[model samples]
Target: MKPNLIAARKPEEAATTHPTILRTVLEYLLDKGVQPFVGDSPAFSNFKRVVKVTRVEEVCEELKVPLTPLDDPIEVNGEIFRKIKISRKVLEADKVVNLPKFKTHSQMVMTLGVKNTFGCVTGLEKSSWHMRAKNYDDFANLLIDIHRIVSPILTVLDGIEGMEGNGPTNGRKKNFGIIAVSRNAFALDDAICSFLGIDHLVYTVKNARRRMVTPEYEVFGSFSSTIQLPSTVSTFERFSRAFSRFFVKYPSIDKRRCIKCRLCEERCPASAIDISKQEIDYQKCIRCYVCHEVCPQNAIKLVRKLI
Candidate 1:
């Protein structure tokens, strides 16, 4: 998926669920006779090794919970999808508890409950969806479709330490000091967006509201701080309606900064990236920001597409 740049923060500080919170949830599930399996497909193919470095393996071991890697894919049909591959274990589970980290996403505007479930799409299949849905609107719809298929029973947002600006992976950490839980992830996500002063018209929010998928819910906590949106979004906001109507932003590889690792090229869903020439085929590019997210050297940058 992507690499985290903040070296000062531990796994929790880097917008992941705190070990204490995870332990509490697991304990509650165990007490209720629900066997909980700590599992997810990490952004990269080497899910096992990455989890260890991120301390997920350690945390699961300390809590005596089995860690399962979501590598096995199960093709399932949805309203908007024909043969999307999702994790088999996720499909087999009686109930799913979503643990989403509150963060600003370059593509989705923000990554909340619904966006987090995209991990169920398996490693490369997650990228392939980007190929199909090239823009925010279609991508958001794709995410909603997958979420509908998974239908997690509960969603717990890790907002205690959240990320703002360019995020989901690379961004500055903010002490949001909040945790939200709900049976309806869409409602919880909407509440979070409202709290952060982000526009409800964001693709996910708009779609959820349009479909009436968001359930009735009440927010118990309040925060007054405004979040810093990604540069691409904030830049678009500064433009007048006329100028903004035509501009598009696409990722560019900083030739000077790239180390030729080809991580972005490999993860690219549409196969538009060429590491040898360090060029991205904009025609085939999906604007998913996977290139920017996976660039280990911080080489990929989002630039406005010239019309």
Candidate 2:
């Protein structure tokens, strides 16, 4: 199940996929005589620890289903990415079930079905991709390539409670209360984007349109809520190099809120953050917002480079 457990610690927070949904899906699969196992590679800690914290371990135990880390990377050369490493367990699986949280992302806009497959890359490789992809569109292309490879048979979105405003983590948990299912993830994402009135906004949707992977689709369900774009979205819209020099949005540390946990420094792919002195080197910063993504304290804030 692809829950957004990136920085979640509690079930009540609804930051990740609700455990109830996991249990229900697992039970339904079991009833259909499907030998299903749950696997995800979280960016923060060990898979077991993260599942335990999110209370997913209990459900898996009670259901007697295997909960695993999508590890042991197997190299696969893609059209856009060469020697890309992915989880062997996932590669060997008969079919993948895309269980994504309907959450807004600081970098990619929304972490929908197409974006959730990034978990298959495993371990630090996910972080390195941020460095390898030179810009927003590049990163979206990487996600698309991986999604095409994973090729999940079914996608079930946990849109019951959506996260908005600087998310994938550390955002408001909204009650959207809708579940979306589709076979083609691209179409599913496209439909959601259309429903949210942001078909032109999400990077993956834009890239999918360019590649023509997104097919004609219709959204049946009706749900309403205003999505809050990430704070960085405003400055990022001006993509021109000249505009970037003056209006770039960068991550800044809120020292008082920071507990010196060092998660951001340890996980920074660019190695731009120095938690010891509480500073980030702007020249080295890649604007991946990874520090913002992984920060447990919500101490990282996105600020404009220029007034």
Candidate 3:
């Protein structure tokens, strides 16, 4: 089996950092005679659009690797996942390596190696999962199921420069200056949470733990001293005070940052969001945090409230 290579993105570099990361990933694979393919399943948007925006195609061309799009739909357990696809080249290759950005999510707490795979699920179908999984634990299990199917041979996190505040997209970038890799996605995430000093109880990691999928695997690479992760902020602290019933932190619209674009309302699966009033109905909200994740303006924040 070819070793999977995961690379980290350094913080503070211009967008040019992607190509450098891509080169490192390709080099590692080429050295082992593994054919490489690159792709991701971004939420609420088309993969082609994200690749174009991120210039991933250009990087693939320069590296002489194939830029494969996941276009075929596969039904796994009657899920009817349309275009529920992955890079065929990658699946057929000796190994599938992942390159994920490091970042904190308004929902899921931190979007690291595992959460990054959500991009593999394909377009609009991704949002329907949000609707189907409705609550945090269910969503997390769904994520695990997806991970089981797409099973990356190895994962590398680009923590050199990562997002914080509210992310996956829509957050300020922070410099973590670390590159981490592991064959065990769970262990890698546990190590990352430890490095960041954040709580592992965050939904995704917690679910991974329950499933016993942690990073008990060996690690390779170096760190610039131990990375100081931000302290764990509880869901209560980050959620809006108004929507307390959901039991998970839901983002509050930052009046100053909010352009009232209604993107959050449109993407919300629970139909809990009321853009007209700019209020979320907690009873209806599932606390998926898709509202916070998809906001382009960084207009949403999680706030804690006294019960």
Against the true structure, what is every candidate's RMSD? 3.2, 2.0, 5.5
* lDDT tens digits by residue: candidate 1, 1-307: 1112112225754645555566677778888888788777767547666666566667678767788777689899877667888988889888888887778888888888888788787767777777778767778888888889989888887778888887766777988888888888898888888876675546798787777777788877675667887756745554463566467678998999999998898989888999999999988886778887776666988888766
By TM-score, who's the top model here?
2
TM-score of each: 0.90, 0.95, 0.76
lDDT of 2 at 36: 90
lDDT, model 3, position 56: 64
As a TM-score, model 1 comes out at 0.90
Q: 1 or 3: which has the higher lDDT?
A: 1
Candidate 2, residues 1-307, lDDT tens digits: the string is 5555664467777667778888888899999999998888898877778899888889999999998988999999766877778999989999999888898998898889899999999899999988999599999999999999988988988888888998878888888788899999999998888788877779999999999989887777675667887777774563454554557679999999999999999999999999999999989999999999888889999888773
* Residue lDDT tens for model 3, 114-172: 76666565555677787776666777777766666678877877777766665555556
**Stretches > 4 Å off in candidate 2:** 235-246
lDDT (CA) for every model shown? Answer: 0.75, 0.85, 0.61
Ranking by TM-score: 2, 1, 3
